[model samples]
Target: MKFLKSGLEALDEVTVIALGSNMAGGYPSSEALLEAALARFPGARLPVLARSGWWRSAAWPDPGEPEYRNGVALVETSLRPRAVLEALFSIERGFGRTRGAANAPRTLDLDLIACGREVIDAPGLVLPHPRAHERLFVMGPLAEIAPGWVHPTLGRSAAELVVTATVGADAIPI
Candidate 1:
């Protein structure tokens, strides 16, 4: 495993990973689950280069549900886009995530927000996650770590998009 060069926005190795957990499952808290989850990425070959602090945000489509703990990680990986996605899903399952009703609370939710500057749209994988820019939970932490990151399709930096994000408007750093 080699480093992806120094500094935040350099190197083509950069990729964005969104982390969310509303249910701790066996962990003590959602925050704890998220922290432990980040630690697992390196073993998956996606070493975390930079990470934002955990954020608290109301659950979407239903605010009455337990709030979600969210954050973003910038990692450097040589894996292709699809492989990167597969690794993320595998990591989620290891933390007890299950596929059920859409948006159901879960022990862990790992999303591949972007793969370098790759703009991909295909079955089972979507780069720069279709709705990620519209969600504060994603954009907020992204802004904290890589404020200048421009979406492949949206054409705006995280710092710029976070202002107008339509979902999770109540999101705030914990």
Candidate 2:
């Protein structure tokens, strides 16, 4: 675990996070919701160091749902991986997201795509987000902010993975 001198000791790794939203009912526009969610990170204890421009893409595995607005952020924090995940969940809830059917439309989605070079496989949290490298939605935004970041397990850089991603070909700048 690398520690930054931000007055915190034994801090966990810096992480890249992916944010997306497709549901707009009962809330602001999906794009606005994403922007608000990113803005709230600092208040939630996860300070964003860098961010990518929002991208619009069709819903994964189910195009019947509303289109999604996606983006990625680089955050530096002292919180552990699980703690960071919990915070993300809280942020989602704050944006009116509710747990439901798998891959169902959501108001907000926040995924911790990578944490430095750490590879964790705990019960609930998986470091480097098991499928990040294979998903265009994740890799596209990630490449924009940290193109040189290498996958801890795959030995591939974000830029490399983005080139090979089979999905997200339809993603467009928002």
Candidate 3:
């Protein structure tokens, strides 16, 4: 996903990320992850309230394990999308996350490049998260932070997409 550097340009930009942990050594709890992120991005202004806690969703490419505790985070950062994603990977590794397989459960899972002001399709990332419009975990938290934020490509709001997306309501707060 692409991000605008200036606050003026990013005013309307929205970013969403999926949070989950169920891999080896187990994933750090949402609260812990949030705390870590804040510490790393000291001066960064986060979304008013990142929607998180717990949820159950179909395990992607990989299945048959415990359901994931999922949510989303809204953040305003000056770092480019790729740079931000690299930071997320570093955090995951610090939390004992290992790349066992694609879609495998992880101790700390962070998928960046959720959505932004511009449509970007890059080697390591894709704008709008490819499925942000179809997943509630990503959209739910995004809505909490940027309800009016419009999708650069679809021209839809986070809340609207999440409400219309197909997802199980069994995802409850921890």
Candidates' RMSD to native: 2.9, 4.9, 5.3
Whole-model alpha-carbon lDDT for candidate 2: 0.81
lDDT of 2 by residue, 1-174 (tens): 111233212113458889999987565688888888988999988998778888999987899889999988878888888888999999999988899888889999999987777889999899979887887888888777667777888988788999888776788766
Ranking by lDDT: 1, 2, 3
Residue 107 local lDDT, model 1: 92
Ten contiguous residues minimizing lDDT sum, candidate 1:
1-10
lDDT per model, in order?
0.88, 0.81, 0.60
1 or 2, greater by lDDT: 1
The TM-scores, one per candidate, come to: 0.93, 0.89, 0.72
- Flag clash pairs in model 2: none
Better of 1 and 2 by TM-score: 1
- Candidate 3: RMSD to truth: 5.3
TM-score of 2: 0.89
